[model samples]
Target: MKRLYFYTFFTIFLNFYANGQALPITEVFNYVIGTNLGGQGGWVNQNTGDEVLVQTGNLSYSGLLLSTGNSVSFAGGGIDPQLPFNAQSGNTVYASFIFRVTDLSTLTDPNGGYFAGFGQTATVFGGTVWLRTAGTQFNIGINKATSLTENTWLPTNFDTGTDIFVVIAYDLAIGEARIWINPAPGDLEAVSPPTPDGTANLNTTRSSLNRFFLRQDSATETPSIVFDELRIGTDWATVTPKDPTFSLEDKFKDRFVVFPNPATNGFVNITSGSQAPKDIHVYDVLGKLLIKQTISGSRLNIQNLKAGVYILKVAQDGRSETKKLVIR
Candidate 1:
């Protein structure tokens, strides 16, 4: 009995550690629409001024999980949101997010400002993403730490009102950072990581990172921007999964459907090409598993769930797909 208990405890500990370290953070901003982002979804308000309001709709890139809920937009002042994660040390940390510049005509700072970055604390930021006007367009740049100027800028200028996907990787071992803009979903899965469009050296010797932040500088320094689908992990693929739309291995890709999405009647009907029994799991915006069961029929009772947005994962024959679920 003693040996069996030891084995069971070891197995459970390994499983927990593996799952805990797989994905350090994922934020879809799937909160109530038209609310401030600070108090919701593990984010804390660091300063005061303009609130980052959650707006309807989300930004998307091809092959990504269908974006759900809403996005947060910021324009001016010093108000920002900070989220702390497990401190990562001596390894590469990767972060990816979708953003768009709605307006930049108000920006006057010649040096521009950082809109997102990794931070050791609410004030110490690095692996910064910067934006500055380039003639009628704008350019995105990256810096390893707090700097007056960007260490490297993309050669191309981008137009306003266009969605851009950005990925940043910071290597603590070497104190270096790399940035890629609009890279294909699976680019990081290659035998070697894809070449970054911009690279920078961490001018200061930093050791660990524990927080992520979204910034809104003064009106003259920052543009009106919207951000969504922020994810951070230890490897490139963890933060930049391939677009599901192009997944040939997804057996239920085009054959599955969920009805009564706004589920007014406290139930949802799922239909798929195959009638095989499916394992169902429902998760909230923070990735908490709220419901889990198996179903052999189309209808699933969800009356116990509160009114809000959720993620529904359906698995059959070892294949699975996730869809956005909203309850009225």
Candidate 2:
């Protein structure tokens, strides 16, 4: 009888583990629009001021799931909402979300401030994403720990009011952090990790991540932003799942052609069904724009690019297509 009872207890424990903490944590902010996010969705308000409120409409990307439901908006003040998760340790943990800046005109600090990050406590944070105004636009950056300023900033400036997918990965064992912005939708973690836009080494005092926090720092430093479809998991595929409804092949079917995919001689040819002049953009895996020019002919020069994988985007008329490119 004791042996039978032990077996029964073990089975129940297994069921709970499988259905609970073992799965990915996702928040679409499904609460009613205009409601305070702190009282709903298991988020605890850390302080008082302009509360993070559920805003109307969801942020969408072409090829990602979890785009349903409303998003939460952070205007300013101290109303930060922190949500706890199963403490993760000894491996890589990934967090992904759809983010957009609504206003940067009020930003007074030149260094900018962090809006979201992973945390061990309400105060201790890491893997933080930051935004700083650059001229009329803004730039996104990442830091590994509680640094006074962002460690690595993307060289490119992004315009406000545009939805962008962001993925942050932190390797606990190696004390390293990496960030990817607007990666291809078909990309999957099971095959390989996408190249990061920015990477930084973490501080020596590594700690387990137990929560994710949305912060509202000083009004002078933080920009007005909206965040939606926050997901946390143990791998990149879990946080950044490809949308089942989108197909890359069908979108570009018979419309464009890129030859010499693995171009060995530093030259590639492009042809389109319309036979119109094409505007070409070549970006490295890091999402950095390396080349931009208008081509009136079939052959384009790429002798300056190093041997590596890149993304080739061609635009003609009012339509555009992107494909993976390789140089050998």
User: Which lDDT tens digits does candidate 2 get at residues 255-312?
Assistant: 5678898999979999875566777889999788999877888788999999999988
lDDT of each: 0.79, 0.78
lDDT by residue for model 1 (116-214), tens? 898876788779999999877787889999687536875545668778888898898998889887664445344456777679984784688877899
What overall lDDT, based on C-alpha atoms, would model 2 receive against the true structure? 0.78
Itemize residue pairs with steric clashes in candidate 1: 63-243, 63-244
Q: Runs in model 2 with CA error above 4 Å?
A: 1-23, 188-191, 250-328
Write down the RMSD of candidate 2 (Cα, Å).
7.3
What TM value does model 1 have? 0.67
Candidate 2, run of 10 with poorest lDDT: 14-23
Going through the candidates in the order shown, the clash numbers are: 2, 0
* Superposed Cα deviation of residue 211, candidate 2 (Å): 0.4
